[model samples]
Target chain A: MDVSQELADYAAKHTTQVLERSQPVQVDMGLLAAFDNTPIDPSEYSSDLDAHLLQLTLTSTQALISALFALPTTPSAEHGPVIRPPVPSTILPREKPLPKPKEPTKWERFAQAKGISHKKRDKKEWDEERQEWVARWGRDGKNKQKEEEWATPVKAGMEADQDPAATARAERKARTAKNEKQHRSNLAQAAASSSASSRRTAQQARAADLERSMLVSKSATASMGKFDKSIEGEPKSRGVKRKFDENVPKAGWKGEKEGLLGVLKSVESGLGRKEKRKGETKEGEVVVRKAVRYHDREERLKAGRGGAGGGRGRGGARGRGRK
Target chain B: MRPLTDEETKAVFEKLANFIGKNLVHLIDRDEDDAYCFRLHKDRVYYLPLSMLHLATSIARPNLVSVGTCFGKFSKSGKFKLGVTSLDWLAKYAKYKVWIKPAGELPFLYGNHVVKAHLGRITEDTPEHQGVVVYNMADVPLGFGVTARSTLDTRKLDPMGIIVFHQADVGEFLRDEDTMF
Candidate 1:
């Protein structure tokens, strides 16, 4: 009887059970998340926030581990045991807004108006003569069967020069070209309808440019629009009227004359500077006169003129040359 | 008719400078009473004096056949081509001159290029491809052309080698009489 308290304490310490919560913890093994929806006691929470949060987290973790263990396990060759998480039950919020629907094409609108439902077609078709299935289109497709045949019969009333194979191939190509043209028109219609205001302004700008070009061409005749054939109800093409300086302005012609001189100055400065330099010598360059005089003296000395009386002989020779 | 725009003025000046060289300054800077200006009328450029410009203002653009000396006309492609009418201005201020013999005068007037056999004399130190005024033995300005060879280079040319390339000649006045205006 006295060992009851000690036995209880020993059992509490040895047991593997986690602290219990007022309400059960919700576990989602797929998301590995647990929700504690139980109300908290103010006294316990206020007494110690760390202990209270720690106890709450431990309880939720214990619930999650138990739920994970309950899942059906399979033995893997590499791993000892493996458990597959089930699909999540919670509907999480999306991060982005829903995508916009694409604009319907031309043919789609026409089909909707006509209440036509789309029917899926098989890619391969059975060829009765070949006894095999062939692609409806693309490489070696059934569409080219007539052109690929060995003996193609000429249709009645056909031209003698017309080739059956060539005609068949041309017809196939024409069909594709027609489809491509229709697809382009569909895209254009979609683009136009999507931005109505912007497209309208663009069309107006193009129309104005076309009108201006037409006016310019109309006036481009040899007679300067005078002898050009006039179109009925066509608006008169107003040319850019020539604007000239007043023949007799209040200000005298001195101002205009000055302006003209200014232009001439600029032109001359651009051209004459380099040409003038071609005739003039550069600054700080020595004259070659002394070199020429030295050469002359050497020539005189070489002409049998001695050293002592060379000056007097040079003077007498100069006097003779002058005479 | 209106005064030439600056771009048109520059174009005309550059073309004029090809023959006249620095003498272009004399054309623009003149006596106050003898001041002149350039005007564009129906693609043709006119070099008219101030007094004449004042008188011609009364005539309507379409009625005014011509205002002053028709120095040159702009082509359909906007390139300026000197007319034979501007020979007076070019000859007066020509920097380089080429004189042709009397026999070659007729051929040159007929728009033939000046050949070595026809070349009488050329300006000394004239560079290749320089614009030169063609003259006759009597010093009469026959036309204008671009030189094919410099003065020194011409000495090496054969008798039949071209000396100057024909550009514009006075013969155009008679040949192109209809569109000369």
Candidate 2:
């Protein structure tokens, strides 16, 4: 046979075998078990099986391709060259050009533009509204309107005629002067009242001291009466000397000697000791003793005089001093 | 100074043994014989063992008579070279002592033998009972130098033996006794 015929025969046979093998088939259980367990003997199989398989695969692929090619083909509609739909001229007007987006409205444009002299520009407006100057032009419309309503207008001619801020300055100066005058007056009044109150307080304190001293004298007199009674009740031996000593005021005593003899004796003893100590010139020993004795006698005499005066005054002052 | 109690001695020995086990690279055996020898590399841990011993002795040595003798040169110059024999002589002079006690229950006899062999190699020249012979890198005498170098370089030493994270108290124990030495 020719080479193509032989190839065709081989392909037909291999395809039939492959188709047969591909179909679901019942297996001989014993044969399958033998084949599964035993290793295949390569020599047992024909080497031509591979070539036959290759031929069968090629034939099947070619048959599929031929079948596909032989099938019908539908012609696509030839709608000429593809053309996009024309955009409406009105959709994108050539002339209007969206007005360059309106240069972003006046306020936006003004905000976007930088480096403006915010202070210099607002000075005139500030002078008019004084406090609400910043709100005059740039603030919200509502606030601007409110500011305008509240704002007082000054005619240029009138502003020039008047000294502009002369009245305000004069008014401020007058108010300050008035406040200073009132403050000075208040300070003077406060100082005078304080001094008067201080003088009154000093006088009251002196009066209280006088009252306290009077009370002390009365109490002392009462204590002296108790002392006299105690001295009298003592036994004669003890009493005589005690009464004599008591009549003669003790050194540093702070009470009165009632009788004339008691005062005369005290004065005699005070003078005698002073002259004796003065005439006997001794060192520290005599000097110190004499000085101490002199101080003691002087203190006693002063106390005696004070007690006598206080005793006499006590009776009269007691009734009046109660309040 | 009072001799360490049995428990304290055991604790110290165990710590030292663990350290040797971690740091020594060519460790022939461990916990084997009564003695152990650790073969150390020229690395940080090698320096560590000797540095630790030096620090411990400096801080803990009872007398001020102790001396330190590094066997090799501090620098490459042979001027610093104190031959091994000289180091041995210095060790004798210092009368340095070394001891090790293992931690936990003792392992097998083989383990003990291995530990002893390892220690023997390190303390080969010096008498085990008299002087210390810690396995350390000849290049880096103190662990501090190696550790510092490693830290600066951001590299790990990757030492061979068991590494023990010493407690802070150990630092207290290792404080220098200026008055002592």
Candidate 3:
């Protein structure tokens, strides 16, 4: 009993001494980083640097592991267990610069110069007659209320044939078209003003257009550029590469059979425009032929009855012709 | 020769269907032992059996004269033109037929259109502008052509009036011998 009591007393003394000298490792689970802020003993470090580093790393890693286990975890079917990481304390730099503010439109610039303050308007407006909130524009909007109305008062000088509702719709459409035109012009102005990026994009577009024109001009020649003189440092022109089915298809017999059948189906459908036109003409001819046959029969009967004796030669010729 | 592209196949099929109608299916969907396919070699379309195609694949494109029946060829402008070489296949499945008299046989073989004076028997109810295989009185297929007028309309036409417009005739085999594959 004295021997067991002595061993327990020694264990308690060693643990207490270690706890007093060492500090808890600081762990940031979000970053998966651990820091050992405890001071290192110069004597122990100098005596065996490798041993000292190993001891320090072991303690810090053990502390981090214990800290990870302390966090609340949820049972996950796929991952077995999952823990939510805390927000990282360290701030990282942005990858790209902040976007530039949009330029003011022509109307906005004019209003600003004229010292006009803009008042925000609600999309929905109160309709007293309907006792409901209706949209200012779009889906049962007030703009189209005149056109949708059951009756509209005709103006004194207006023509009887002129519809006020149709006029109102046309006016609204014109207004929308004008607004769209103005918006496009404003966008063009903005693009022109933004020189740096816009200029680079414009240059790239111009290069692409030049390339396309060059290809077209080259092909326009009688020899299709074959006899054209080569320019210094000119990139070689490349036509579309031809692709063919595999000499021996990897899919084996079934794919080849299906492809052939598919082609046959398209053919039976008369996919070509020329073939379709011919089919149409064929149908038209049948109707015209029937009419012509009726006309011929009528003429033959008339001739036979009018000149029965003289028509004998023609009738004989017809009989012989039938053979 | 490579397998015909879908567009090329469509062109060839559209041309063939004009003569054979829906019977084009028999040429594609056949028994496993006798499966045939379409292959394009030097602009000319060839209809060869699968086993023959495998054997012909070993020969170089220039060395391979032809495989199976030379159905037709695609022109420089991509239009498919049926040739006399496909007359055998066209004759077998022709939906409508136009028979010429023995007197007109020589002229038809000489690549002339069958005239009303030489017309013999035509398929009853044959529509105008329909593709019909030309046959002699003995039921021998001479060539194929399109009808200028329907069966009823032909009765009112003058004896010298054209009845059938010549398309591809057997005469092409000898006339176009140099280019006929």
TM-score of chain A in every predicted structure: 0.45, 0.15, 0.45
Which tens-of-lDDT digit does each residue in A200-290 have in candidate 2?
5556789777766654554477564345433333332212331122211343122321222233344445545644644454333456666
- A83-176, model 3: which lDDT tens digit per residue? 9989876566998999878978999999999999988899999999999999999998998999988988887999999988889999999999
What CAPRI class is candidate 1?
incorrect
State how far residue B69 of model 1 sits from its true place (Å): 0.5
Give candidate 1's error at residue B1 in angstroms. 1.2
Error of 1 at A75 (Å): 99
In candidate 3, what are the lDDT values of residues B70-103, reduced to their tens digit? 8988999999999888999999999999999999
Q: What would the per-residue lDDT of candidate 1 be over residues A1-323, giving only the tens digit for each residue? A: 59999999999998655667778898888899999988987998999998888888888888998898999999999988999899998789999998666779877888899999877899999999889999999999999988988987777998989878898999999999999999898878777777787657577889878878878898888887888788886666675886767555458767766666676667667667645443233234544655688988887776545533345556667756775
Quantify all predictions' global Cα lDDT against the true fold: 0.84, 0.34, 0.84
DockQ of each: 0.21, 0.01, 0.33
Evaluated against the true structure, the overall lDDT of model 1 is 0.84
What DockQ results for candidate 1? 0.21
Off by over 4 Å in 1: A1-244, A247-250, A272-323
Q: RMSD of each candidate?
A: 30.0, 44.9, 24.3
Error of 2 at B10 (Å): 30
